[model samples]
Structures are given as C-alpha cells and as structure tokens.
Target: MLSPSLPRPLQPRANEVLPARLALSAAAAAEGIQLLTRDFAPWLAERGRANEFRVDRIPFADLDGWSFDEESGNLAHRSGRFFSVEGLHVTEEGQPYGDGPYADWHQPIIKQPEVGILGILVKEFDGVPHFLMQAKMEPGNPNLLQLSPTVQATRSNYTKVHRGADVKYIEYFVGPRRGRVIADVLQSEHGSWFYRKSNRNMVVEATGDVPLREDFCWLTLGQINELLHRDNLVNMDSRTVLSCLPHPDAGAGALLSDVQLRSWVTGERARHDVRVERVPLAGIPRWKHGESTIEHEDGRYFKVVAVSVRAGNREVTGWTQPLFEPVGLGVTAFLTREFEGVPHVLVHARVEGGFVDTIELGPTVQYTPDNYAHLGEQGRPLFLDTVLRARGDRVRYEAVHSEEGGRFLNAESRYLIVEADEADAPQDPPPGYAWVTPAQLTSLVQHGHYVNVQGRTLLACLNATAVKGA
Candidate 1:
C-alpha cells in the first residue's frame, strides 16, 4: 500500500508546490482526464484557456474493470472490467508527504444529473501501489468507465475505510452553490444514506499530502458518483445539488443519470451542507440604512413596492485556487405564491424595474378617502409639486397655511423643494440679501415702490407720471 509522509506543519508558505497541488482549480489540473470529460469541457472553455487546464488527453492512465448494479445485475456482463486509476493520492502513511511531483491531483465530489450521488471511490487494491477511481455518467457520453458497481447494490464496493486523511486527502472541497451530500455504503439496506460534507465555500486549497495506508481507502470524486446511483426511475432536483469537477476540463464528464430527478433550489452556500435552512424572516428588520427606509442595503430613495427572493448557485468562474465560491445570498421570498399576501415580504417601490429603495419614496400620504392619485405619484412628489407651484410653473393654486408644530410635514400647505434635472425649468432663486444700491436708495425716497427684477426702479415710472409724461 502507498504511504504518504506528511509535513509536521499543515500550513505551507508562499508559492510552494505543496500548496499548489492542494489547489484544485482550473489552472492547476494536470494529473487526470477527469477535467477533460465531456461534461466539463464546455463549462470551462473560457476558464481552461485562462487557467491552462486544457490538455490533448485526459490525465491518469485508465485501468480495465467491471461494473455491477443491484437492480440491473452485472453491467459489464462476465467481464466486470472496472475503471481504476493509477498515480493518484496515496494516504496510507499519514499527511505531509514530500511534495508530489505533479501537484494537480485532487479528490473532487461529483453529482450526476438525476441521481443522489455518483461517488468516486478513492481506493488502493489490496497491497497495491495504484489508486482506484470510479464515476457514473449518462449512457450517451462517448467515453464510459465499464467496471462500475450495480445500481442500489448494497455490496456495491462502498465504504469510508479511513477518516485519517480527510484534512489531507480532500484538503478543501468547495463549489459555487449549495447541495446535499451523504456518505453511503454498499449494503442490503433499502434506503440510501447521506453524511454531510461541506457547504459552498471557495477552497483556498483543494489538494494536500494524502497519507497512504492499507486500511483507509482513498475517496475519489468518481467513486462517490458511482455509489450514489439509484436503480429505479428516481427524480432529483439539480438546483440544490453541487457537482464538482476535478479540473475545469473535467466538468465535461458530468451528466445527470435520470432525466426526471429533482433537487431543491438553494441560495449561495450559507452553511457547510447543501440542505438550506428556511430562515424565518418574519419581522426580520427590513433593509435599513442611516435613518432612511431603503428597500435594501443601498439607500437609493425609491419607493419599494415589491421584492422577490429565491435560491440557486453560479458555476465556476476562474478563481485563485478552488474556482467555486458562493456569490450571492438567497431569499425565502418567492415571486409566485398560491396564498394571497405572502408573509415573507419585500419592498417593491413605485419606481422602474431595477432595485428602487423605499427611502426615496415620500412618506405614505395616507389621506383616507382621498388617494393622492391626483398628484402624479413620484418619489417625494409633494416636494416636487411644491417647487413647481412656487416657481410659477402653474397658473393657479390654493393658498394654504402651515402649522407651527409641523417640522417638515405640513397638512394645510405642503412646502416642497425640488432640484431640476436640467437647466430649462423656472426657479424662484432664494431670496437674495443685499445692501440697497446707491441709485435704488435715492429712488426709494423719491417713490413709494421699486421694481425688484435686476434692481429696476418704479421711481422712474412715477417720476414720469409726475412730469405729465405717458
């Protein structure tokens, strides 16, 4: 059996090759064609070029094998030629083995489209130096690993012999979104089993020094895929499950086994497991900012009339090491609901399609029996309308009085201030304070009135009247 010697210290500093292999990313993949599989090719087309995971052929030399399914019996007929792997991680000894020559090897967790788990079995044959890796894929894919276990087979060669190398073997398992994962065994039990692994967190490192040992079997991404296959027509929701690719290129190999399987939709990876918890947003404080009622964190002053919430995940956009990371959070609110007025609410402002903050919407003019529909509702329309009336934008208006107690909100006369979008709008410039001009002072004494525009004088007009001029 292969025994890997590990470093005493887990942390490896700067640009070291040891940490590089631990980095299961689009760029660092070099060991297996696991990245080149058809499912992964297109997913990382842009990323492969960016990261250089693309290669002419798949990595890892393929070993002959056989496959079995509990429901279908022997998939490989008499020759259960199992697909095995060579030159992969050996965790028999312990962690911190001398840095392996090719540092790209990683144990990826893959989920087929319709099935519960298409687990990759990371194992070593009895006293053998080679590593055995297996995966289950859709039948249509061109390259198929024939030596696979029977579907729902209890004796399907499944077991987690060792947890000793988890820190080292799996290093860091990360993904773009959320999904449920469980550990299973090939047993006679009727139902499948699951054990939570991790949530959608970006991996700082994906590979590590896998200690080799006879007792502990290596858990490869492919082997996990096989153990999860279901025999009957089962449905799965892909929205909640995360399928990991070894390299960006390896994304090509993944495929959903059954078309009808369903999975739950999830938001960005909140916890370590794929099963998303329903957070009670009841009375959860609405999005707030500094003293303003913003619909969201951004304090734009739009009235929020509606808000929608849902959950899902993003695929790999190239990252530093592990390419997957949870991008955004999910909402418990849904757009469509059978029941009227869903308890979970979002502020949909009376604004355009994009996010409109509730703060921008003026105070609800809840004048009962009189909908303020006449004012052409816009954000802070009361203020805007007042500006229009004061600056002679309107021909007529009802003069109203203001209360001494009202700070800014006045019922009788609502005084509003508005800034123009452009320069063409008329404005009553703020009352200017100035000393009387020498010419205007003399005119004021001569006549009782004075024209205010640009300091024009009524004194000249009155003087003309006194002189008998028209």
Candidate 2:
C-alpha cells in the first residue's frame, strides 16, 4: 500500500475499503484505475509530479484520431469533451437494451448521419457519477473509473461527465462513428464498484450510501427542477439523470424525477403507493410556485384527501415541511370548515425513531404569536398563516392569516440549550417546543395565538425527551 501521506495535493483518493466479509477487489493490475478525461497527459503529468516518478511519456492514438466528431457537436462545447465520434462503430440494431435475464433497460437511437444528439452529445451526467467501463475498438471494454462520492478516508466528494438527469452517453456502437462502445452500467454509488471490466455486463451490487447525510443528488436536481414544478404537479425532477424516465402522467419523453416519494398517502389512508412523478421547475414564471391545495365541498366538514409535506428523516433540511407533512397524518376526520385561509396544519407529534417516519401522540399547540409582536419586537407580523391543530379538548385557538400570500409567520421552535423533559421551560418565548404532535395521551391542541399571563409570543413551543421508545 502507498504511504498515507503520498497523495499530497492530489487530496486522497478513495481506493477501496470493504470488510473481508464484503470485500471485493480487482484480481490483477492489468488494468490500472480508470481516469475519464479528455486530456490524459495533463492528468497523468499531475499524478506523475505528485509521485516523484518521471517515466517516458509515450502516447499513441488507437483509431488514428479519425473520429465522427461533428465540430458543431459537443467536443466543441465550452465545458465538455469537445471531440465527436471519429471511428466509432455505428450499429443499426434498433433492439431493446438487453434481455431481462441479464440486461434491464436500454435506449435505442436512430443513426443520425452527422448532427446526432443535441447539447453535449458526448457528455452524460446523471445523478452522482457511477463507474463506467471503457474499451477501445480492438480490445474489449473494462472498468475504467468509479464515479460517486469518495472519502479518501479524507478526500472530497465529486462527480464526472453529466450533471442533471438527461445526458445521452456516447453509444460507441452506433452514434456517428461507432465501433462497439457499449457501457455495461452498474447502478451504484461511487466507491461501491472499485473495479469495472471491459465487455462485462452491468452488474448490481448491494452497498450502503452512508457517506452522504448530504443528499446532493436530490438537492441539486431539485433546484434545477423547481422551475419545472411551477405549473405541473404530476412529477418530481430527478438527479444525475439525463432526461425523464417512464412515469404514468409524463409524456413519452418525460424524465424520472430525482426526489423519490417513498410513500404517498391521503391522511394515512395511503392513496398512491407508487413512485411520484417529478415536474421540472425550469422556465416557471415568477408568479407560479407550489401551493398547498385542498378540494372542498359546499357543506361537509373539509376532510383532507391530500397533503404534501416533506417527510423522511424528520430532520428539517428544507422549508417545505408544511407542504409535505399533513397529507401524511392520515386524517379521517372532516377538516374544520374554517380552514379556508392560509392553512397551517402544524402537528407536534413525536417521531417514533430517528429513522422511523410515523408521527405519534405528544404535546404542542398551534397558535399565532400575540399580535405577531409576540414573536419579537416586530412593527407588525406577516399575519399570513391560519393555524390548525389536533390536540386534546382544552387548548382552543385562533390565528391571523393572509389569504393572498399563502404562508405562515411561525418560526420553527428549536433547542438553544438542552433541557430535561422533566425540566423547566425558560421565561421567554419558551424554547424546547416539540415539532410534531404525539398520537395518543391527549392534551389541549390549541390553535390561534394565546398571549399567556406573560407577553412573549411563542411561549408554548413544544419539546421532547431523548428517552427513545419511552
């Protein structure tokens, strides 16, 4: 093994670190690690400099540099491989990707004479990059580089080739100049597959993506997709994907959304169970954004048939919780008729586990800060939310809501100082307020801001005890 300090400015590279029970490695070093780059000399030079090894730099072109690269195509782009297909073998088989027993899905491309695919035809960046097999015409393909987040035990995270979901990889077998450039794709994380062999089929390996508490794949693509969601509610955008995949409401060419909606329920009734469709936020007008909607009848109690709050992990990574949670409560009761204005169905239930998603009985009430100034010395509060709650009988409620803007003036109650569950709440807008409501053990589920004997606006915030499964 190389000395740990040898990486130097190269910032360590995640070599391989699987346990003996799950350890898998390359049999031999016939194929050195694959590095995908347009300019190999520079990359090699950098590595050589770092290693203090000066060897003869002999370079030769495989196909004699005769490529089908349409100058108008990608190799000409500002930030991508500007080369086009020189001597690639263009296949005429309009066959499916492969048979199910072995291969899963494949895209059949009609041989274009010259222009071929649009955008960067040579680049494909979808989700975090994965290991790809590289091969020349004469020699079979072999695993070149694994592209996913790597830890050098101490390196940084990164991706290669494509960026969002719709990149079209260079199909060596059939673009302009095709000569058998087929990718045996293994859908995996960066370090999962440390080796890729040429001519081998795409393999599926089981490994955990524990490196990222950071879901950059979903987060980045979600931003690129925000504009797309403005008008369409049918789908969610996807990450690392070149284009949308097959979804029910999506058109023939719709892409698979990056955000995987694990479960979709109408108040816990579990209305839709399949994956959600991703709508791109691209090109969305300023006036348009996602809004919490409800289908109400004339006189019946407004029961919730749908909700859209951000779930999973219970951790507040984004501000879309209000939009993603209630639809999750599985409410069977008719919603209060008065819930017409900016509806805020804030629940203060305890999460079953740090990993579980179920919201159970607990204590916390929904109310507006007294005059919004209760929140602080504000000239005036946004008064934009209409608070709604599900608590025991005592806590009655009211709220100052704005029907036009559609948002809440409530701040997420959090812990500044750790307090015991049996501990006392501080004097000011009392901290330690729990974020969710427990399922049973009923208590007053107050709505509307109630200025207590004191004047702090957010005094009755909720909190929890770390006592797991108590």
Candidate 3:
C-alpha cells in the first residue's frame, strides 16, 4: 500500500491545450553541440602520462573452488575459498549467508560484499558545473573505454581498514571535503536474479582545487548530454547518475502547460494497477534452473548462465557468477513528434516484476521476443509494432550498449529514437501513457519517479538536434 503521506496523484487540467513548438534557444543549442564534440580521452591519457588501460579475462580455473549446485539452484564456494559469489542467502528477512530455514516464497539473493562505489566528482569551471568522469575500461563493454564515474571503487578497495588496496581521490567522498550531495540513492540491481546493491551513486561539488587523475576528464552537463547520443560511449552507471541530476523546467519552449501535464500524469498514474508478489525461485511457473542455464519453457526471454571473469582493476583478479543473458538484442526507444513545433516524446508507465516502485516511466518499447511469442495485439507492450516498423529516417539517435558488466555476463540493447508524424501519433494515448516534454521528464527524474533505468538511458541519448530542431 502507498503511504498516506505521499502526495496525491496529479490530475489533468480540463481543456488546456499544449503549445505546438518548443525549441531550445540559440545558446542552449550551441552548448549541446559543444558538449558532443569535446574530446576527453586523449587529454586524460596525456595528463596521466600513460597508455590507455586494457582489460582482459582470466581462465575459469583461476577462480578457486567455485561451483554451481544443481540441487539447491545456487552457486557455492568451498571452505577456505574466496570468489565473487559474495553473500548467498534468502530475502525473507535480510538474513546472512547460510542454509536457510527459508519460507516457501523466499527468493535467493547474491549479496556482493564489495559495495562498489559509483562516485562522480563535480567541479565548477567558467561558472558552469562540470563533472569529473573517467574513461575507464570494463571487461564486458563492447567499446572497452566508455565513460565511467570518476571514482568507481568497491568497498574493499576504498576502505584501508579492510586490508584492501587504496582507492584514488577517495577522500572527496569519505573525507572532510565530501562536497554537496547531488544524488544519493540505493538503486537495486536486477532483483529477479541477483540482489546485489551498491552505495556508490553520488555527485558532489568540490570546494577546493582537486587534483586531476589520469584517465579522468571534466565535462559539463551539456557535454555529457551530447556524449549520450552515441552508443556505448557512456556506461550504465553514468547514465543512472546523470539521470538523477536535477533539471528544473524553466518553462522555456514547453509544449504543455504545467497544470495540464500534471493532470495528464496523475490521470495516467490512476489508470493502471500493478501487482507484484515475491515467489520462490524454485516455483516460478514455466521456468527451470539447470546447472548451466535458467530458461523459460519457450526459451524466448532470457537465461542465466555461468561465466568466468578476470579484471586487472577489480578487487579480485577473477571470479564467476550466473549472469542474465538475453537471447537476442532488445530495443528501447521513445517515439517523438513535434506537437505545434514543440517536441514531446511518448512515455510509457510500465511495471516490471522486480522494480522497487510498482510502475515507473519507461520508453515506448523495451523488449526482446525470445520467450514472449504471445506478445502481439493485446500485449502489455502496446505500440511495439509501430516502433519496430518505424522508418529509418525517423530514427534520430541509436546506439547499442552492453548491460551491467560486473553483473550480467553479456546482455545488450539497442537504444533508439523514432520520429512520428503528428497525424500518425495517437490522438489520445491509451491508459497508463502520456506525451511528456523532455523538461517534464527531467523534472520527474529530479523527483526520482516516472523514469526507469532503461528510460533514463535512452533519455541520456536525447541530443541538440532533437532538442533544438523540434
């Protein structure tokens, strides 16, 4: 049940018409382009006085005594052994690792001990807020050197007390100069499978002159936004943190009046009912967990598979886990059109089985049909056909990025932007949907509602062309 103190759902204002065109000013447009073209990798490498980092995988045998248990449907480590399997336990009451006297409905959780910190250091230059980002390499990323957070460290690496190695610039976060907290939230991982969580998402403003580190570069919000238009250029963690940056709608070039938009959002929020119940991993219908794979009866959605990993930068040189593998590349997109010259993207209020919130705003289509052969006319993903059949010219931005490398072994999705004609756009979108301005969406992001990870990832891709041209 929703708490009583929570604000009432917003309702649409009657007969309020939105503006047709809401274009960005000339200054904003120039800023967007500047952000897109700024080169940071070469500069960072020169500063560090080193070659760009390289990442490689280690052999499976290097992981000491790690094995999968067919009987319990869990991964295990033998005594006196240490691997990345972290903590193994049930989620009934947040208990520690052990054989569980678990309830029938209890879900298994893999609590990775490394409490990895996904921290970004922010500094001001030329009176504009600039973020300190790293051109870091991940073993699983298609482009090895995508932009990463300034300080991506696990708990073991950051805390000297743990006898782990030291993390660079760790003082900015934990020390006396931890800067202002822009965003700090404990976002959950893929909850259906791994219960791994991290405390690393933070954006702090530096007060003093902070030394620049090798492989790290300073970027403005506009630059970051421009970089998001390219595929795999920005990592998932960076996208999530970037989504948390507060974007207050100045009402500049807004298509809809704030009142009307709020009403529409509130109406959509009231239109759908989402039901979620935790079930035992062993009892989910039409699913089977084998020693090698977790699959649906139809084998169309995703699978869980074991893999070996080795990384030079991670706390451990090697480890293994059952990672979620999508059978095919999925598509996540937003359908946009100029309404009276103002651009608005179609946003879906979607529900996922594992989401912390029952329903959050999502892209127009987020799907892979591997196990979902039945998702056609009457499916939850209502307009996927329209999006998939969209013309190539309608595509404004598209890029492929691998999912979380540390968790999922290999999973990727095509993030896209498709333009629709107002004539073809839904005159009245079905229940649980809304046409929201990018500014409104950004405001929703500030409140930390409406937008989901996939939605934010795609939103991060929205560029000056889409922002100004529309």
**Whole-model lDDT values for every prediction:** 0.19, 0.18, 0.58
Candidate 1, residues 1-470, lDDT tens digits: the string is 32233212223442333213322221222223333233333432332233322111111111112222333221121232211111111121221222112222112111111112223222222211122221222121122111221111111112222111122123212122111111121111000001111112111221323344222222222322222221110111110111121111111111211111011001111111211121221222333212112133332212111111111110111111100111121111001101122111011111111111101111111011122233345322222233343444321111211111000111122211122222323222111111122222222222211211001111111111112211
Best by TM-score: 3
User: Backbone clashes in each candidate structure, one number apiece?
Assistant: 94, 99, 17
Q: lDDT tens digits, residues 299-395, model 3?
A: 7666655666544544444445445556788788888877666778888766444455545678878776553556544343566777788888888
Off by over 4 Å in 2: 1-223, 234-347, 350-470
Evaluation by TM-score, superior candidate among 1 and 3: 3
Superposed model 3: Cα runs more than 4 Å off: 1-72, 76-117, 125-129, 153-163, 184-200, 220-223, 252-280, 373-380, 463-470
Worst 10-residue lDDT window, candidate 2: 189-198
List, residue by residue over 1-470, the lDDT tens digit for candidate 2.
Answer: 65533321211222121111111111111222233222333442343233221111111111222222233111112232312211111111222211011111111111112211111111112312222221101000011111111110000001222232221232222223332111122111110000110111111121223121221111111122221112211010011111211111111211111121111111221221112111222221121112222212221111111112221211221111111111111111111111122111122222211101122222233222331233353322111111123233312322111110001111122111111111222112122122211111111111101111011111111111111101
